[model samples]
Target: MLFSFEFSPIAVATLTFLLAGFVKGVIGLGLPTVAMGLLSTVMAPAQAASLLIVPSFVTNVWQLATGPRFGALARRLWPMMAGVVVGTLAGTGFMQGSHAGQAAIALGVALMAYAVLGLTAMRFAVPPRAERWLGPVIGAVTGLMTAATGVFVIPAVPYLGALGLPKDELIQALGLSFTVSTVALAAALAGGGSFETGTAGASALALAPALIGMSVGGWMRGRVSERMFRRCFFLGLLALGAHLASRALI
Candidate 1:
Protein backbone atom coordinates (compact mmCIF):
# COMPACT_ATOMS: atom_id res chain seq x y z
CA MET A 1 0.00 0.00 0.00
CA LEU A 2 1.16 3.53 -0.70
CA PHE A 3 0.16 4.68 2.73
CA SER A 4 -2.48 4.59 5.41
CA PHE A 5 -4.77 7.56 6.21
CA GLU A 6 -2.86 7.93 9.42
CA PHE A 7 0.14 9.22 7.49
CA SER A 8 0.01 12.91 6.65
CA PRO A 9 2.41 12.57 3.73
CA ILE A 10 0.13 10.20 1.90
CA ALA A 11 -2.88 12.41 2.45
CA VAL A 12 -0.99 15.51 1.32
CA ALA A 13 0.40 13.78 -1.75
CA THR A 14 -2.97 12.37 -2.70
CA LEU A 15 -4.72 15.71 -2.34
CA THR A 16 -2.01 17.49 -4.27
CA PHE A 17 -2.32 15.03 -7.14
CA LEU A 18 -6.09 15.31 -7.14
CA LEU A 19 -6.01 19.09 -7.16
CA ALA A 20 -3.42 19.17 -9.92
CA GLY A 21 -5.43 16.79 -12.04
CA PHE A 22 -8.57 18.80 -11.56
CA VAL A 23 -6.86 21.94 -12.76
CA LYS A 24 -5.55 20.12 -15.81
CA GLY A 25 -8.99 18.78 -16.61
CA VAL A 26 -10.53 22.23 -16.50
CA ILE A 27 -7.81 24.34 -18.06
CA GLY A 28 -6.03 21.74 -20.21
CA LEU A 29 -2.72 22.35 -18.39
CA GLY A 30 -1.08 23.29 -15.07
CA LEU A 31 -0.86 19.82 -13.54
CA PRO A 32 2.86 20.15 -12.98
CA THR A 33 2.48 23.70 -11.77
CA VAL A 34 -0.09 22.74 -9.19
CA ALA A 35 1.55 19.48 -8.16
CA MET A 36 5.04 20.89 -7.83
CA GLY A 37 3.96 24.02 -6.03
CA LEU A 38 1.74 22.26 -3.53
CA LEU A 39 4.04 19.32 -2.93
CA SER A 40 7.07 21.49 -2.43
CA THR A 41 5.41 22.86 0.67
CA VAL A 42 5.45 19.41 2.27
CA MET A 43 8.62 17.70 1.02
CA ALA A 44 12.00 18.18 -0.49
CA PRO A 45 11.79 19.68 -3.96
CA ALA A 46 13.39 16.71 -5.71
CA GLN A 47 11.27 14.18 -3.86
CA ALA A 48 8.17 16.15 -4.70
CA ALA A 49 9.21 16.25 -8.31
CA SER A 50 9.87 12.54 -8.35
CA LEU A 51 6.33 11.96 -7.13
CA LEU A 52 4.96 13.85 -10.13
CA ILE A 53 6.61 11.66 -12.78
CA VAL A 54 4.13 8.83 -13.23
CA PRO A 55 0.97 10.89 -12.96
CA SER A 56 2.14 13.62 -15.30
CA PHE A 57 3.41 11.09 -17.80
CA VAL A 58 0.19 9.11 -17.74
CA THR A 59 -2.07 12.14 -18.03
CA ASN A 60 -0.12 13.77 -20.82
CA VAL A 61 0.03 10.51 -22.73
CA TRP A 62 -3.74 10.28 -22.43
CA GLN A 63 -4.04 13.83 -23.69
CA LEU A 64 -1.77 13.13 -26.64
CA ALA A 65 -3.57 9.96 -27.63
CA THR A 66 -6.94 11.67 -27.53
CA GLY A 67 -5.71 14.45 -29.75
CA PRO A 68 -6.12 14.55 -33.55
CA ARG A 69 -2.52 13.67 -34.49
CA PHE A 70 1.02 13.52 -33.19
CA GLY A 71 4.41 12.74 -34.89
CA ALA A 72 4.49 16.10 -36.65
CA LEU A 73 4.16 18.01 -33.42
CA ALA A 74 6.78 15.89 -31.74
CA ARG A 75 9.13 16.48 -34.66
CA ARG A 76 8.51 20.19 -34.62
CA LEU A 77 9.22 20.33 -30.93
CA TRP A 78 12.38 18.20 -31.05
CA PRO A 79 14.61 21.09 -30.21
CA MET A 80 12.64 21.72 -27.09
CA MET A 81 13.00 18.07 -26.21
CA ALA A 82 16.75 18.13 -26.61
CA GLY A 83 16.96 21.31 -24.61
CA VAL A 84 14.86 19.86 -21.83
CA VAL A 85 17.20 16.89 -21.46
CA VAL A 86 20.34 18.96 -21.42
CA GLY A 87 19.00 21.63 -19.14
CA THR A 88 17.54 19.20 -16.67
CA LEU A 89 20.77 17.22 -16.43
CA ALA A 90 22.82 20.37 -15.97
CA GLY A 91 20.46 21.81 -13.39
CA THR A 92 20.43 18.62 -11.34
CA GLY A 93 24.09 19.12 -10.60
CA PHE A 94 23.18 22.08 -8.46
CA MET A 95 20.85 20.34 -6.07
CA GLN A 96 22.92 21.64 -3.19
CA GLY A 97 24.65 24.55 -4.80
CA SER A 98 25.20 27.69 -2.79
CA HIS A 99 22.53 29.33 -4.94
CA ALA A 100 19.89 26.75 -4.17
CA GLY A 101 17.73 29.23 -2.30
CA GLN A 102 18.12 31.68 -5.13
CA ALA A 103 17.03 28.98 -7.54
CA ALA A 104 13.90 28.43 -5.47
CA ILE A 105 13.20 32.14 -5.48
CA ALA A 106 13.57 32.10 -9.24
CA LEU A 107 10.92 29.39 -9.37
CA GLY A 108 8.49 31.58 -7.42
CA VAL A 109 9.27 34.47 -9.73
CA ALA A 110 8.69 32.23 -12.74
CA LEU A 111 5.29 31.16 -11.43
CA MET A 112 4.19 34.71 -10.70
CA ALA A 113 5.36 35.78 -14.11
CA TYR A 114 3.36 33.04 -15.76
CA ALA A 115 0.31 34.00 -13.73
CA VAL A 116 0.66 37.65 -14.76
CA LEU A 117 1.04 36.68 -18.39
CA GLY A 118 -2.11 34.61 -18.18
CA LEU A 119 -4.03 37.49 -16.61
CA THR A 120 -3.03 39.95 -19.32
CA ALA A 121 -4.20 40.15 -22.91
CA MET A 122 -0.78 39.76 -24.45
CA ARG A 123 0.56 37.18 -26.84
CA PHE A 124 3.89 36.93 -28.63
CA ALA A 125 4.43 35.89 -32.18
CA VAL A 126 7.67 34.17 -33.05
CA PRO A 127 7.77 34.24 -36.76
CA PRO A 128 8.84 30.83 -38.11
CA ARG A 129 12.22 32.32 -38.87
CA ALA A 130 12.72 33.13 -35.24
CA GLU A 131 11.19 29.94 -33.85
CA ARG A 132 14.11 27.91 -35.15
CA TRP A 133 16.30 29.75 -32.67
CA LEU A 134 13.84 30.39 -29.89
CA GLY A 135 12.26 26.97 -29.44
CA PRO A 136 15.31 25.21 -28.00
CA VAL A 137 16.25 28.22 -25.92
CA ILE A 138 12.83 28.30 -24.30
CA GLY A 139 12.89 24.56 -23.81
CA ALA A 140 16.26 24.58 -22.09
CA VAL A 141 15.18 27.28 -19.67
CA THR A 142 11.96 25.43 -18.97
CA GLY A 143 13.98 22.34 -18.17
CA LEU A 144 16.17 24.34 -15.87
CA MET A 145 13.11 25.69 -14.12
CA THR A 146 11.65 22.22 -13.87
CA ALA A 147 14.79 20.84 -12.32
CA ALA A 148 15.02 23.65 -9.85
CA THR A 149 11.37 23.94 -8.81
CA GLY A 150 9.45 21.16 -10.57
CA VAL A 151 7.48 23.70 -12.60
CA PHE A 152 7.66 23.63 -16.42
CA VAL A 153 5.06 25.96 -17.90
CA ILE A 154 6.70 29.29 -18.18
CA PRO A 155 8.28 30.08 -21.53
CA ALA A 156 7.25 26.74 -23.00
CA VAL A 157 3.48 27.29 -22.80
CA PRO A 158 3.71 30.95 -23.69
CA TYR A 159 6.02 30.11 -26.53
CA LEU A 160 3.65 27.45 -27.76
CA GLY A 161 0.79 29.92 -27.51
CA ALA A 162 2.64 32.31 -29.78
CA LEU A 163 2.65 29.75 -32.58
CA GLY A 164 -0.93 30.68 -33.44
CA LEU A 165 -2.17 27.22 -34.27
CA PRO A 166 -5.73 25.98 -34.26
CA LYS A 167 -7.09 25.15 -30.83
CA ASP A 168 -6.72 21.40 -31.21
CA GLU A 169 -3.24 21.67 -32.58
CA LEU A 170 -2.15 23.85 -29.71
CA ILE A 171 -3.51 21.39 -27.22
CA GLN A 172 -1.73 18.54 -28.96
CA ALA A 173 1.52 20.43 -28.96
CA LEU A 174 1.19 21.10 -25.26
CA GLY A 175 0.68 17.44 -24.59
CA LEU A 176 3.83 16.61 -26.47
CA SER A 177 5.77 19.33 -24.73
CA PHE A 178 4.59 18.31 -21.30
CA THR A 179 5.26 14.65 -21.99
CA VAL A 180 8.79 15.49 -23.00
CA SER A 181 9.24 17.61 -19.91
CA THR A 182 7.99 14.85 -17.65
CA VAL A 183 10.30 12.29 -19.20
CA ALA A 184 13.26 14.61 -18.94
CA LEU A 185 12.45 15.20 -15.29
CA ALA A 186 12.24 11.51 -14.60
CA ALA A 187 15.53 10.98 -16.30
CA ALA A 188 17.15 13.72 -14.27
CA LEU A 189 15.86 12.25 -11.04
CA ALA A 190 17.09 8.82 -12.01
CA GLY A 191 20.45 10.23 -12.97
CA GLY A 192 20.71 11.97 -9.63
CA GLY A 193 19.75 8.78 -7.79
CA SER A 194 16.76 10.51 -6.27
CA PHE A 195 14.18 8.28 -7.93
CA GLU A 196 13.76 4.54 -7.39
CA THR A 197 11.34 1.75 -8.08
CA GLY A 198 9.66 2.36 -4.75
CA THR A 199 9.08 6.02 -5.55
CA ALA A 200 7.79 5.04 -8.98
CA GLY A 201 5.36 2.62 -7.37
CA ALA A 202 3.96 5.28 -5.10
CA SER A 203 3.61 7.65 -8.01
CA ALA A 204 1.80 5.03 -10.04
CA LEU A 205 -0.65 4.43 -7.22
CA ALA A 206 -1.33 8.15 -7.00
CA LEU A 207 -2.62 8.06 -10.56
CA ALA A 208 -6.00 6.77 -9.43
CA PRO A 209 -6.83 9.96 -7.57
CA ALA A 210 -5.36 12.09 -10.33
CA LEU A 211 -7.46 10.48 -13.03
CA ILE A 212 -10.59 10.59 -10.92
CA GLY A 213 -10.09 14.26 -10.17
CA MET A 214 -9.53 14.94 -13.84
CA SER A 215 -12.84 13.29 -14.70
CA VAL A 216 -14.64 15.41 -12.17
CA GLY A 217 -12.97 18.53 -13.42
CA GLY A 218 -13.80 17.58 -16.99
CA TRP A 219 -17.47 17.27 -15.99
CA MET A 220 -17.36 20.55 -14.13
CA ARG A 221 -15.71 22.34 -17.04
CA GLY A 222 -18.86 22.20 -19.09
CA ARG A 223 -20.90 23.61 -16.24
CA VAL A 224 -18.45 26.31 -15.18
CA SER A 225 -17.18 29.53 -16.69
CA GLU A 226 -13.78 28.83 -18.22
CA ARG A 227 -12.75 32.47 -18.28
CA MET A 228 -13.57 32.90 -14.62
CA PHE A 229 -11.92 29.60 -13.79
CA ARG A 230 -8.76 30.74 -15.56
CA ARG A 231 -8.66 34.00 -13.69
CA CYS A 232 -9.09 32.20 -10.39
CA PHE A 233 -6.40 29.72 -11.34
CA PHE A 234 -3.89 32.44 -12.06
CA LEU A 235 -4.80 34.21 -8.86
CA GLY A 236 -4.32 31.03 -6.87
CA LEU A 237 -0.99 30.45 -8.56
CA LEU A 238 0.08 33.96 -7.65
CA ALA A 239 -0.70 33.31 -4.00
CA LEU A 240 1.15 30.01 -4.08
CA GLY A 241 4.13 31.63 -5.72
CA ALA A 242 4.19 34.28 -3.04
CA HIS A 243 4.19 31.65 -0.35
CA LEU A 244 6.99 29.67 -1.96
CA ALA A 245 9.06 32.76 -2.55
CA SER A 246 8.58 33.92 1.00
CA ARG A 247 9.48 30.53 2.37
CA ALA A 248 12.62 30.31 0.31
CA LEU A 249 13.77 33.87 0.83
CA ILE A 250 12.86 34.23 4.46
Candidate 2:
Protein backbone atom coordinates (compact mmCIF):
# COMPACT_ATOMS: atom_id res chain seq x y z
CA MET A 1 0.00 0.00 0.00
CA LEU A 2 1.19 3.48 -0.80
CA PHE A 3 2.04 5.66 2.18
CA SER A 4 0.85 2.84 4.44
CA PHE A 5 -2.69 3.53 3.39
CA GLU A 6 -5.03 0.56 3.47
CA PHE A 7 -6.33 1.01 -0.07
CA SER A 8 -3.84 2.71 -2.34
CA PRO A 9 -4.25 1.38 -5.87
CA ILE A 10 -1.39 1.96 -8.26
CA ALA A 11 -3.59 1.61 -11.28
CA VAL A 12 -6.04 4.16 -9.94
CA ALA A 13 -3.20 6.59 -9.44
CA THR A 14 -1.85 5.97 -12.94
CA LEU A 15 -5.20 6.60 -14.56
CA THR A 16 -6.03 9.56 -12.33
CA PHE A 17 -2.86 11.42 -13.20
CA LEU A 18 -3.26 10.59 -16.85
CA LEU A 19 -6.74 12.03 -16.86
CA ALA A 20 -5.83 14.98 -14.67
CA GLY A 21 -2.88 15.84 -16.87
CA PHE A 22 -4.99 15.60 -19.97
CA VAL A 23 -7.44 18.09 -18.51
CA LYS A 24 -4.65 20.46 -17.56
CA GLY A 25 -3.12 20.19 -21.01
CA VAL A 26 -6.42 20.97 -22.64
CA ILE A 27 -6.98 23.86 -20.27
CA GLY A 28 -4.16 25.67 -18.52
CA LEU A 29 -4.89 24.40 -15.00
CA GLY A 30 -6.84 21.81 -12.95
CA LEU A 31 -4.06 19.31 -12.24
CA PRO A 32 -4.21 19.66 -8.46
CA THR A 33 -7.94 20.18 -8.37
CA VAL A 34 -8.58 17.10 -10.43
CA ALA A 35 -5.94 14.99 -8.73
CA MET A 36 -7.04 15.73 -5.17
CA GLY A 37 -10.69 15.19 -6.03
CA LEU A 38 -10.05 11.82 -7.60
CA LEU A 39 -7.30 10.53 -5.32
CA SER A 40 -9.17 11.34 -2.13
CA THR A 41 -11.75 8.71 -3.02
CA VAL A 42 -9.42 5.82 -2.21
CA MET A 43 -7.04 7.58 0.17
CA ALA A 44 -6.94 10.43 2.64
CA PRO A 45 -6.68 14.04 1.51
CA ALA A 46 -3.29 14.28 3.15
CA GLN A 47 -2.03 11.28 1.23
CA ALA A 48 -3.44 12.61 -1.99
CA ALA A 49 -1.84 15.97 -1.32
CA SER A 50 1.46 14.21 -0.82
CA LEU A 51 1.14 12.65 -4.25
CA LEU A 52 0.21 16.04 -5.66
CA ILE A 53 3.24 18.02 -4.46
CA VAL A 54 5.89 17.09 -7.03
CA PRO A 55 3.75 17.26 -10.15
CA SER A 56 2.03 20.46 -9.08
CA PHE A 57 5.30 22.12 -8.20
CA VAL A 58 7.04 21.02 -11.38
CA THR A 59 4.25 22.01 -13.73
CA ASN A 60 3.62 25.35 -12.05
CA VAL A 61 7.30 26.22 -12.05
CA TRP A 62 7.41 25.50 -15.76
CA GLN A 63 4.45 27.75 -16.25
CA LEU A 64 6.01 30.43 -14.05
CA ALA A 65 9.32 30.41 -15.93
CA THR A 66 7.78 30.69 -19.37
CA GLY A 67 6.75 34.28 -18.85
CA PRO A 68 8.68 37.43 -19.72
CA ARG A 69 7.73 39.68 -16.79
CA PHE A 70 8.80 37.70 -13.79
CA GLY A 71 10.27 40.67 -11.98
CA ALA A 72 7.18 42.80 -12.43
CA LEU A 73 4.76 40.06 -11.54
CA ALA A 74 6.80 39.03 -8.54
CA ARG A 75 6.89 42.55 -7.27
CA ARG A 76 3.17 42.90 -7.73
CA LEU A 77 2.29 39.63 -6.10
CA TRP A 78 4.88 39.23 -3.33
CA PRO A 79 2.55 40.35 -0.58
CA MET A 80 0.01 37.79 -1.66
CA MET A 81 2.66 35.10 -1.73
CA ALA A 82 3.88 36.07 1.70
CA GLY A 83 0.36 35.94 3.04
CA VAL A 84 -0.08 32.53 1.47
CA VAL A 85 3.00 31.26 3.25
CA VAL A 86 1.87 32.68 6.55
CA GLY A 87 -1.65 31.39 6.24
CA THR A 88 -0.54 27.93 5.23
CA LEU A 89 1.94 27.62 8.04
CA ALA A 90 -0.46 29.05 10.54
CA GLY A 91 -3.15 26.56 9.61
CA THR A 92 -1.00 23.45 9.66
CA GLY A 93 -2.74 22.11 12.74
CA PHE A 94 -5.82 21.35 10.71
CA MET A 95 -3.99 18.65 8.84
CA GLN A 96 -1.66 17.53 11.60
CA GLY A 97 -4.37 17.25 14.22
CA SER A 98 -7.36 14.97 14.61
CA HIS A 99 -9.31 16.69 11.87
CA ALA A 100 -7.99 14.54 9.07
CA GLY A 101 -11.35 13.08 8.13
CA GLN A 102 -12.99 16.48 8.06
CA ALA A 103 -10.46 17.65 5.51
CA ALA A 104 -12.18 15.53 2.92
CA ILE A 105 -15.37 17.42 3.52
CA ALA A 106 -13.54 20.69 3.14
CA LEU A 107 -11.97 19.47 -0.08
CA GLY A 108 -15.38 18.52 -1.37
CA VAL A 109 -16.82 21.90 -0.58
CA ALA A 110 -13.87 23.65 -2.19
CA LEU A 111 -14.17 21.63 -5.36
CA MET A 112 -17.88 22.26 -5.52
CA ALA A 113 -17.48 26.01 -5.06
CA TYR A 114 -14.70 26.19 -7.61
CA ALA A 115 -16.67 24.10 -10.08
CA VAL A 116 -19.74 26.23 -9.68
CA LEU A 117 -17.75 29.39 -10.23
CA GLY A 118 -16.22 27.99 -13.39
CA LEU A 119 -19.50 26.61 -14.67
CA THR A 120 -21.22 29.95 -14.23
CA ALA A 121 -18.43 31.88 -15.98
CA MET A 122 -18.66 34.57 -13.34
CA ARG A 123 -16.28 37.47 -13.83
CA PHE A 124 -15.02 40.14 -11.48
CA ALA A 125 -12.66 43.04 -11.97
CA VAL A 126 -10.19 44.26 -9.37
CA PRO A 127 -9.26 47.85 -9.65
CA PRO A 128 -5.63 48.76 -9.25
CA ARG A 129 -6.40 50.86 -6.22
CA ALA A 130 -7.91 47.94 -4.32
CA GLU A 131 -5.20 45.43 -5.17
CA ARG A 132 -2.65 46.91 -2.79
CA TRP A 133 -4.76 45.88 0.19
CA LEU A 134 -6.91 43.08 -1.20
CA GLY A 135 -4.18 40.82 -2.50
CA PRO A 136 -2.67 39.66 0.77
CA VAL A 137 -6.07 38.99 2.26
CA ILE A 138 -7.03 36.90 -0.71
CA GLY A 139 -3.73 35.07 -0.62
CA ALA A 140 -4.00 34.31 3.06
CA VAL A 141 -7.48 32.93 2.64
CA THR A 142 -6.31 30.87 -0.30
CA GLY A 143 -3.42 29.53 1.74
CA LEU A 144 -5.60 28.56 4.67
CA MET A 145 -7.86 26.73 2.28
CA THR A 146 -4.82 25.09 0.77
CA ALA A 147 -3.64 23.95 4.17
CA ALA A 148 -7.04 22.62 5.07
CA THR A 149 -7.92 20.85 1.85
CA GLY A 150 -4.76 20.85 -0.29
CA VAL A 151 -6.58 22.68 -3.02
CA PHE A 152 -5.53 26.24 -3.81
CA VAL A 153 -7.68 27.44 -6.66
CA ILE A 154 -10.41 29.42 -5.02
CA PRO A 155 -10.03 33.16 -4.37
CA ALA A 156 -6.53 33.19 -5.83
CA VAL A 157 -7.54 32.14 -9.32
CA PRO A 158 -10.51 34.44 -9.30
CA TYR A 159 -8.41 37.27 -7.93
CA LEU A 160 -5.81 36.79 -10.65
CA GLY A 161 -8.47 36.87 -13.34
CA ALA A 162 -9.72 40.17 -12.02
CA LEU A 163 -6.37 41.88 -12.52
CA GLY A 164 -7.05 42.83 -16.13
CA LEU A 165 -3.77 41.40 -17.35
CA PRO A 166 -3.18 40.46 -20.96
CA LYS A 167 -3.71 36.83 -21.76
CA ASP A 168 -0.04 35.84 -21.61
CA GLU A 169 0.66 37.81 -18.45
CA LEU A 170 -2.50 36.46 -16.87
CA ILE A 171 -1.38 32.93 -17.61
CA GLN A 172 2.00 33.73 -16.14
CA ALA A 173 0.38 35.32 -13.11
CA LEU A 174 -1.66 32.17 -12.51
CA GLY A 175 1.55 30.18 -12.77
CA LEU A 176 3.19 32.38 -10.21
CA SER A 177 0.24 32.18 -7.85
CA PHE A 178 -0.08 28.41 -8.17
CA THR A 179 3.66 27.97 -7.80
CA VAL A 180 3.63 29.85 -4.55
CA SER A 181 0.62 27.94 -3.34
CA THR A 182 2.34 24.67 -4.16
CA VAL A 183 5.44 25.68 -2.25
CA ALA A 184 3.46 26.93 0.71
CA LEU A 185 1.48 23.71 0.69
CA ALA A 186 4.68 21.70 0.60
CA ALA A 187 5.96 23.57 3.60
CA ALA A 188 2.74 23.00 5.50
CA LEU A 189 2.76 19.28 4.77
CA ALA A 190 6.39 18.93 5.69
CA GLY A 191 5.77 20.74 8.94
CA GLY A 192 2.89 18.41 9.63
CA GLY A 193 5.27 15.46 9.12
CA SER A 194 3.38 14.13 6.18
CA PHE A 195 5.78 14.74 3.34
CA GLU A 196 7.70 11.52 3.67
CA THR A 197 10.02 9.69 1.25
CA GLY A 198 7.45 7.22 0.03
CA THR A 199 5.03 10.03 -0.70
CA ALA A 200 7.66 11.94 -2.62
CA GLY A 201 8.63 8.90 -4.67
CA ALA A 202 5.02 8.10 -5.50
CA SER A 203 4.41 11.71 -6.49
CA ALA A 204 7.48 11.65 -8.70
CA LEU A 205 6.43 8.39 -10.29
CA ALA A 206 3.01 9.82 -11.08
CA LEU A 207 4.67 12.61 -13.02
CA ALA A 208 5.46 10.53 -16.09
CA PRO A 209 1.93 9.53 -17.00
CA ALA A 210 0.78 13.07 -16.21
CA LEU A 211 3.29 14.50 -18.62
CA ILE A 212 2.41 11.94 -21.26
CA GLY A 213 -1.26 12.72 -20.92
CA MET A 214 -0.52 16.42 -21.09
CA SER A 215 1.42 15.90 -24.31
CA VAL A 216 -1.46 14.02 -25.89
CA GLY A 217 -3.97 16.60 -24.70
CA GLY A 218 -1.82 19.45 -25.95
CA TRP A 219 -1.72 17.85 -29.38
CA MET A 220 -5.49 17.65 -29.41
CA ARG A 221 -6.10 21.12 -28.02
CA GLY A 222 -7.08 22.93 -31.19
CA ARG A 223 -8.99 20.00 -32.59
CA VAL A 224 -11.54 19.85 -29.78
CA SER A 225 -14.02 22.34 -28.43
CA GLU A 226 -12.42 23.85 -25.36
CA ARG A 227 -15.66 25.36 -24.10
CA MET A 228 -17.39 22.02 -24.18
CA PHE A 229 -14.46 20.26 -22.58
CA ARG A 230 -14.38 22.75 -19.72
CA ARG A 231 -18.07 22.26 -19.11
CA CYS A 232 -17.61 18.54 -18.85
CA PHE A 233 -14.66 18.99 -16.55
CA PHE A 234 -16.54 21.26 -14.15
CA LEU A 235 -19.54 18.99 -14.24
CA GLY A 236 -17.35 16.09 -13.28
CA LEU A 237 -15.89 18.10 -10.42
CA LEU A 238 -19.36 18.95 -9.22
CA ALA A 239 -20.33 15.32 -9.10
CA LEU A 240 -17.07 14.28 -7.51
CA GLY A 241 -17.35 16.99 -4.91
CA ALA A 242 -20.83 15.89 -4.01
CA HIS A 243 -19.68 12.31 -3.70
CA LEU A 244 -16.74 13.24 -1.50
CA ALA A 245 -18.82 15.36 0.84
CA SER A 246 -21.57 12.82 1.07
CA ARG A 247 -19.18 9.97 1.59
CA ALA A 248 -17.42 11.86 4.36
CA LEU A 249 -20.75 12.39 6.08
CA ILE A 250 -21.54 8.71 5.85
lDDT values for all models: 0.83, 0.88
Give the true-structure RMSD of model 2.
1.5
Give one clash count per candidate, in the order shown: 0, 0
Q: How does model 1 score by TM-score?
A: 0.93
Tell me the lDDT of model 2 at 61: 87
Q: Candidate 2: global Cα-lDDT?
A: 0.88
Most accurate candidate by TM-score: 2
**Predicted candidate 1 versus true structure: per-residue lDDT over 53-142, tens digit per residue:** 999999999888887868778778888878877888778844334655765677678788888998994788889888778888998998
The segments of candidate 1 whose C-alpha lies over 4 angstroms from its true place after superposition are: 1-6, 95-100
Q: Which portions of model 2 show Cα errors greater than 4 Å?
A: 5-8
